[model samples]
Target: MWGRSVPSAHRTGRWDTGGVASCFGSTVEQTASPGRKRGQPGACWDQTGANGTKRVADCRHESHTSHQTRLPQRSRTGPARETPAINHSGIKRSFTAWRASRRGKGLDIGRPPEHDLRSIMNAILYVDRTGIPWRYLPHDFAPWETVYGYFAAWQKEGVFDQLNGLLRRLVRETEGRHGEPSACVLDAQSVKTSSNVPAAGQGIDAGKKIAGRKRHIGVDTLGLLLAVWVTAASVSDNAGGMHLMSHIAATHPRVTKAWADTGYRTKAIEHGARLGIDVEVVQREPGTKGFKVIPRRWVVERTFGWFMHHRRLARDYETHPHRSEAMIHIAMIDLISRRLTRESTPNWRDT
Candidate 1:
């Protein structure tokens, strides 16, 4: 028969071909056909059609052919897709060197990670800098969950605190200063909490009238962060001072004196005495009404201002205060890394 011919089916049953299979009926010719030869085209029998008229159709020349042709070509081998490394605010070589020297001292959790620590740290900084939720991390970086998991782990391990301490020492040494400061400044800022921050994690600051958390910080005379602590906003400066003093004592043994404002005068003195450190209060000028920069106290205030420049620090969104502390360390690393690089570079303008 002309065109393609289909085989006669003894019973009506559906057939499925991996590819589209066109249905064809027997030719109208009276002669029964033999098996198709190699030279003939492929065909299928269609006995279930409404009309019993014999029909012939080609299966290879159907509409579905276009779809098969459009499929991607199979490949034998290629490099697997990988998450790109984050370069922006990534760990510097100096910082890496410092971390390596200190790595075995801590962070010795058994098996290694799939992603490099540098990439993970950069991913974390990217999240903090952009103020995005953990799940919203860009696909180009390591998986958001992985990055956050490492962040939380490191936070609990006090890795960020170690980084902040080590980097601060390096910065101070580069500036021809002692690795440890003898005197430090104390201050606190009350920041409102975001919707993500639970009510259980927050309290109202009666003084600032802010319902959130208070960031209590200790900075060296050079305004470098020595310690950072977060507490409920309702915690008075005196109460926060006790925690801050204890933290400073543990981390910065060389810090013998701390300067603060009137809010911390009595508590600072009392705590400092117990810790064997002197506390000095720098009171605002009696007649000064607005914006007087009190000496010693202004240094810590300026440090707080620097923290404000980071969008993530504008409000407390972290459910845990430890995460907030890690973010602070990340921000300071960004700042001090740039400063260290600039100082090492020669002044082209002067030349």
Candidate 2:
């Protein structure tokens, strides 16, 4: 009975294992005694033979134990992977969307039958971003020569000047017809330039009181750039009074009050009076030994800060003054677009 006891039908097949059946076609039968552990070592059986004839065999227990022991433990957590960085396609799509918006408004002509507006804008953006010389603009963005040609053509045609005026007017009209600003903030900033540009001659040098050119800007309360004029650095602020106010009066007839610093005290007051504008020059305390910046004069300074975002405006890069002014208009367009888009979006306050 101890010699490999096989279980009968009444037994739940367990150890005291005995004969095996055919292993072919995957099903192999093993017989074990009643109430014995089926997989106990040295007590299990398997059969292997051909044509329904089977051989009884003991499965090597040591080999089975060793095989189980060699398997490596698996982790409960899953495998590792990688993540992507930037979406270049998304940026391209945004640029295309912006361009399409402009085209829908008839503001963008894919290209000039002679010169393309899209290419012109790209060149201007490139130049402004890089602060590079116009001649150095890459050929892919319309020839640098062509970009300059169109730039000059637009300036002489007064397109930039007109655009600046139009933007200010539109903003004013939309803001409940406030009408032209009665008061304007005036400020001047020095734009350092390459020594290559000719120095201001005697009278011009005497006027600005500096070595090179200076840019005087006038801006209204809403930060709209009104008039921009370039003169020699040495030109006294008061000296250009007549010319500057003339430019302002021509663009904005309703300007009645002018605000300026002490440098513009006399002439701005005189010009304002003549144009029916009351001049309000922020006065500095005479006895104050320390240099103090004026507060109300900062509006124009803020507009200059806006322009500085365009790298090209940080310095005057153009060989001609008017071309430099055109770049300013392009910067204004960018600013207006951003402002308008923000205003148009819903829940802008939460954003």
Candidate 3:
């Protein structure tokens, strides 16, 4: 009860009032050690029992030091249930209809596939949403090589593109619109590329200050993707826009009217006009300050936002621009399929 002064050397160690040794993250009181120098931080104490037995306290945080206060052994009942972020029933059910349609079209060939179609789709979606390298896919899914093979096969055979069309039409019809849109919005986004992307395929966008590739997409009023084109960032908006509008003209001929930003000013307009389509540039009001949403253009911007929700589309990782376009298509297909199934879009956050 009487204390002239509490020295700083022994400040870190406290006197123990409780003699029992307890563990499992319980507080440990250390007996104060005189001359507890800055470099000498360990505290050990000796206690005498009523039986005249001497008990040594060996509590220390250093390696290889053992203490009587041990934590309980883990129950080790079993591994936790596997909750896949992209392998939910909603996605599988939606894909089932597309697979059935393929069967109806006599799309089957050769022997049966080695891996389950459902597992392959799950692996593909997992890679897209998490942006992990193919080799890094979890062992619980199919082999990474098989998954990539299916992904590339789907792209090369136009299976993904057709699936995208089916999903897009379904979403449009779900929203009370015709399967084909009469009006659309067009836009481009420049994203940096991964190192694996060849220098020949990469370019610098002086406008957005991004050095990589450009994504030109046309979307309907509901923000569903109509077409996507990936090119080097060096390509001007006019060029990308022409390519994009031509795609819309060929596929969604009903999209007679389209809206774009100021970047697609002159040549794109003429190109669209020649294609029997009218392209309008939605400009922000002159006096507007920060982040004003331009009419008929924000929809395409929102579509781009949707692409970013899938981590693979956050940057250009594909070695070929065509594959980049395929990746984007997969993202959109995942989106529209979920929409048709009335399920929430699978996101990395849930993983």
TM-scores vs. true structure, each candidate: 0.66, 0.60, 0.70
* Residue pairs with backbone atoms closer than 3 Å in model 1 (clashes): none
Q: On residues 1-351, what C-alpha lDDT tens digit does candidate 1 reach at each position?
A: 123343443123322231232324323221112344433443334433677534354344542464556667888554554555656555476667776776668878877547777789889888767778889888878998899889889988988878888888899999899998888888899999899888888999898889999998888988988888888898888877878889889877888888888888675688799998898888777789978878888888888887776778889888898888888888887767767765432233444
RMSD of candidate 1 to true structure, Å: 12.7
Q: Which candidate, 2 or 3, would have the higher TM-score against the true structure? A: 3
The residue ranges of model 2 lying beyond 4 angstroms of the native Cα positions read 1-115, 174-179, 201-210, 285-293, 343-351
Task: Please rank every candidate by lDDT, starting with the best.
Answer: 3, 1, 2
Cα lDDT over the full model 3: 0.79
Clashes per candidate (backbone, < 3 Å): 0, 13, 0
Q: For residues 147-265, what per-residue lDDT tens digits would candidate 2 score against the true structure?
A: 87777787899887777677767777777767577667777776666656665421234444445567777778877888877766666677565566778887788787678887787
lDDT of 2: 0.66
Predictions ranked by TM-score, top down? 3, 1, 2
Error of 3 at 171 (Å): 1.1
Q: Model 1, stretches more than 4 Å misplaced? A: 1-113, 343-351
In terms of TM-score, how similar is model 1 to the real structure?
Answer: 0.66
lDDT of 3 at 317: 86
lDDT of 3 by residue, 235-316 (tens): 9999989998898899888888989889988889999999989999888888899887788888888898888888998988
